[model samples]
Target: MNAEGTSTAGATPATVTTIAGSDSGGGAGIQADLHAFAAHGVHGTSVVTALTAQNTRGVTKAEPAGTAMVAAQLDAVLADFDVRAVKTGMLADLDTLALVAEQARKGRLPNLVVDPVMVTTSGDSLFEGDPKQYLHAFADSPTVITPNVIEAQQLSGTVIRDLADARHAAETIARSGPRAVLVKGGHLGPRSTSDLLYVDGRAFTFAAEHVDTANTHGTGCTLAAAIAANLALGLDLVQAIDHAKRYLTRALKAAAGQRLGSGPGPVLHSVPVHSAPEFATDA
Candidate 1:
């Protein structure tokens, strides 16, 4: 299952897959995941479980893909690629969630990063019902679960007002079975952000500067995908998170000056390490 893809120069790049919904806005979901994977120099494959009609403004409509189609996409990817890492987002329904959980149990999902994506950056609910019930299926499965402040609150059943509250919530959510829980601090407050990583009964905090920008559309998906990419590059759990956070910070900062839409735009996935001009290509 560790098959690698060979590039033209005979260099084999790691394969990473995202089982997620499609975002017509080109800012989040499958589009964002693929952009992140490419930025990390990994080959990306995707299984679309839902189709969302959305823009930088907000999601207007979403339709869950048929179970058969979802399963078929999964089968095709798993059969052909030696996927090194996987990230799941917006499972959309119980049936879709169950199918993914089944695959995880069967050892088909390696280095799985489960982003319990329930809401959009624009305050729109992406999935139906409480995500806590759906996420419980992955209790013993994912390598790590990434949830923002709102999602952590939902999973841990607590209100997070400060870093202390964030730590408590991370620990509580980790009890559900993920090897690690990352409670993103993007919604913590108006000051700089601090993410809490809870793993193996210990907690570590990662501080990040708050970029003054409204174009933070695909931050969650980009972070999770970046972590998956780092994992595919053979970094350990903590190292992957640290590197992913740094990558996200750069992307957010680079995206600050761009105006993509009327609402929040996406981070600059193409500029992973440097500013726009430093890394700009003519291709």
Candidate 2:
């Protein structure tokens, strides 16, 4: 293990890019993505999709970058960096989503982990377009799409009340063109959290004891970004997701006792998780 407690043996030093928005609170969006990449020992790059005036309390205002500016950032990053994996968050609207989707289709965004960030943790919608168009535009591009229960319901038209519902939702969403879909169940249960991964017509369940804390802002972005980082580190899709899940669990646990803001804060990304507890243990 390296100094950060992340395994480095046989791991290539690679770059992972996040095409997402900026969170002034430094909790979610590109901030969370970069933190996850650094935690996994991968160099991080970013193409800002939007700018948001948000804090742990909630998002107050958001404005997407112009399509031209988004394109320029993508061009600059893809031109200069051999980014091994890409994770997307908070595309903001259909126009922004379409632009990123074009790059994914062209294979510029590799090992893509799409976190369908439609709303904030505080229940504010960030997307500003037709929901159907937003869903359709994502088809046939991402390697895996990670959606929380709310977003999964939007994508699959299913009400998820349990792991079974989540499984069905994952399968339904997988049919829409992503190679895999993870329906996150963080909001499903009171005592435990489960995530259903549907891939290759099969479903895998990852469950963990719920850490009781309000410091869960940006978890979705963090998990997706960690998946991209693990992929950039050369882990396969399932391995990457598994490792990412473990990493996020650890971060949540570490953040349980601390307070970062006036409202729900973020996971403790700066803490070293290698030996503090352990890495890649069952979640």
Global lDDT for candidate 1?
0.85
Off by over 4 Å in 1: 1-10, 274-283
Candidate 1 lDDT over 1-283, as tens digits, reads 1222112235678899999999999999999999999887789999999999999999999999978999999999999999999999989988889899999999999999999889886788887777787557898889999999999999999999987898888888877778788889898776656788888888877776778988899999999998898898787787777778878988999999999989899999987432122211111
How do the residues 1-283 of candidate 2 rate in per-residue lDDT, one tens digit apiece? 3543355767666888999999999999999999988887788999999999999999999999988999999999999989989999999988898899988888888899999888876889888875555458778888899999888888888899987888888888877778788888887866657788888877777766678988999999999998888787776777777777778888999999988989999998865534232222221
RMSD of each: 5.8, 3.0
The TM-score between candidate 2 and the true structure equals 0.92
Q: What lDDT score is found at residue 240 in candidate 1?
A: 78
Candidate 1 least-lDDT 10 residues: 274-283
lDDT of 1 at 269: 95
